[model samples]
Target: MSAPSESSSAPRAVNPVLAAVAWLWVLVPFGYGLYQLLIKIPALFGG
Candidate 1:
């Protein structure tokens, strides 16, 4: 078998704290929107 290629090598690592913050950056607003939807859904259903 041929040796591994550069493109096929393992990917670089990321900072864990930065990753967590990036995820929260996206997820926090999504979570808040979901929470607001849950609060409004019952109003739409009339109960």
Candidate 2:
């Protein structure tokens, strides 16, 4: 048995799958934008 204050103060657990999905949600767009920039770099130099 635990105290009410201790339980309330404990940090909530996060699901790994949800965490990964959240990370990918942010990274995927960022990665795509970076790829687009890289693709355009050669164009900028007329390559």
Clashing pairs in 1: none
- What are the candidates' C-alpha RMSDs? 5.0, 5.4
Per-residue alpha-carbon lDDT of candidate 1 for residues 1-47, written as tens digits (9 for 90 to 100): 87878678679877799999999999999999999889988877797
lDDT of 2 by residue, 1-47 (tens): 76567457658787799999999999999999999889989977888
Candidate 2 residue runs with Cα over 4 Å from true position: 1-12, 44-46
RMSD of 1: 5.0
Global lDDT for candidate 1? 0.90
lDDT of 1 at 41: 80
Q: By summed lDDT, which 10 consecutive residues of candidate 1 come out lowest?
A: 6-15
Candidate 2, overall lDDT? Answer: 0.88
Candidate 2: how large is its RMSD? 5.4
Q: Mark the regions of model 1 whose C-alpha exceeds 4 Å error after superposition.
A: 1-12
